[model samples]
Target: MIKWVAAFLGYFIFRFPGAVLGFIVGSLFDNMGGSNGGGRNVFQDLTRQSVSPADFELNLLSLCSIVIKADGQVSQRELDYVRQYFLSTYGKEKANAIFRTFNDVIKKREVSAQRICSYLVQRTRYEVRLQLLHFLFGIAQADGQVSKAEVIKLRELAGYLRVGQHDFESIMAMFIKSADNAYKILEIEKTVSDDEVKKAYRTMAKKYHPDRVVTENEAIKKGAEEKFKEVQKAYEIIQKERGIS
Candidate 1:
């Protein structure tokens, strides 16, 4: 449908050749599951590669730089946390190469969160973006606390990435401990009945399940596993609090 519409528009604006080119480009978008795909089935098949591994690392580095500098004072611990994470995820050599680029070039400039996040929104799945947010929160918490400034920047990035408010708050609650953090993690209100709470837990568990994150990268899979555990932990806390068996 998108290809046909684009072809028609192109033909109207230009000629036969324009329609051909428009259709070719539209097919690419369709295969990769464009913005309308809602971030599902991204890179599901080995033959269809939406974004390259290099591009993923670079964009991720860009986001890291944005969050690291958000609090006005760049802490070494935060920097090391980013470095160590990438190092552990991608082997030593690739991670070192990425950080080299990051230190010399990417980190020195003002990264446009809107542009980077927009690209991510189109290319990556929602589950992948959730892990990206989780990683950023880890960076913010690396220095012992998540500052107000960092939270503001993270929320802005999340909005730009088109992540829903409930999902954003759920990840945020995982790091920022509070009396009702469990409820927030479950994306439900404390006023809801036990049955509703159970339902929400089941929903979140399925949503954040490690298997839902389809990737060959062990680090990404592990991150999803950690997220799944957090959901389970939130349910446990709620169960204990409400005395639900």
Candidate 2:
């Protein structure tokens, strides 16, 4: 408990303080009753990654239900996409139980997309949230192309998550391969010179770099690596299109 408090002691102001920091501090403290050792504590402190970050798995599924339902139709493809995401992330034992929870949450009107996004944004770090957006897009694009409704809902969800405009746009660009999307992924103007395009790609390389994520969770770190690879692919596509070496 003292370690948890000391871990975030600087964040607590005279007032209650901000949401993200407050959420992390409170969640860490609250989770203490359930489960560690001094060496484990020191290890976890260095990693800044918990096995389950702020009870995120259920929240992920809840938000996913909102995403796949945007088109007013939930296909088998969409259902399976959610299943695979959970299965791959948490394995069969937990995935089966979590899917049931997802169904229950979807049936209730008590949770809104905004509320789900806000709750997650408050608790987890940015890279994890970025992956949440990534999964949402993956589900939306499962049927090949994203529908207008899904796009609007995704943008709104990103707003709620407080994802930066450029970052959100970059991710959107990656999923939309048409419409000079490579340049969009790099966040460069269509008319930008090759040098400018290279600069943008380098900037994104730094942003999505796996080591930059600073998470102890190997799973989360792998997600970051995948995202970075997406950025690399986008840059390569742009170069191919522009005939740039």
Candidate 3:
């Protein structure tokens, strides 16, 4: 559509009357499309102002593939995480289109790490990119462990995003640790007596109570909720195992 419009405008721009007619026709076309103008001139102006949706979608898929392949082997769990994330963020149809683009890139083996990193740096804002890194880290840890390959890839991505090493390590540590595992997260042992389990849960619950953290900072509330949930899950697992519940 843009190409044809540009060609028509180019051919019609030579004569005074033709130029005037072309300008009016181009304005009409732009208004119809809700664009500032029609043809190459309009496109150049738009390009200078913002990133294109196609570029955003391509970058998103490339980042997903990079994180999924980080574990040396991509497991069903990881793939499911990606699929679920896409479904949540985008509708199923759009997610499928994005997935197809990702597969195409993999099949061709034509995409380079440098190219992807460059595009991400140029196109994404800092907070968004950081959140994306956290999402990747969460996906990597979803199966109860993080592989060395996954950690390396995460660091590589951190480098690309220009996230400081200290900040990356801090966030990575939070995810890699089994926040979902009650016993591990609370530092309780499987062999701990029923009373000990209850005591640990009480202690950890007090520390992670969402209200307490929410007062400190809104962001800390999320961490607090995760920790509190872990405490509950751990207590339940232990109680069930010991036949207390």
Report the number of the highest-lDDT candidate.
Answer: 1
- The alpha-carbon lDDT assigned to residue 98 of candidate 1 equals 77
lDDT of 2 by residue, 79-157 (tens): 8888886676567987798788878876765557777777666655676667778878989999788899999999999
Q: Model 3 lDDT vs. the true structure?
A: 0.62
Q: Tens digits of per-residue lDDT for model 1 on 1-245?
A: 77888788888888998899889877877765752322222222222235566676677788888999998988999989988986776669877887898785434766889999888888766666777889899999999999999999999999998889999999999999999999999999989999999999999999989887666666777778888999999999999999999
The lDDT for every candidate, in the order shown, is 0.82, 0.74, 0.62
Candidate 1 weakest lDDT stretch, 10 residues: 39-48
Q: Which residue segments of model 1 deviate by more than 4 Å?
A: 1-49, 105-109
Q: Model 2: clashing residue pairs? A: none
Error of 1 at 135 (Å): 1.0
**Per-prediction CA RMSD (Å):** 7.6, 8.0, 15.4
* Local distance difference test, candidate 2: 0.74
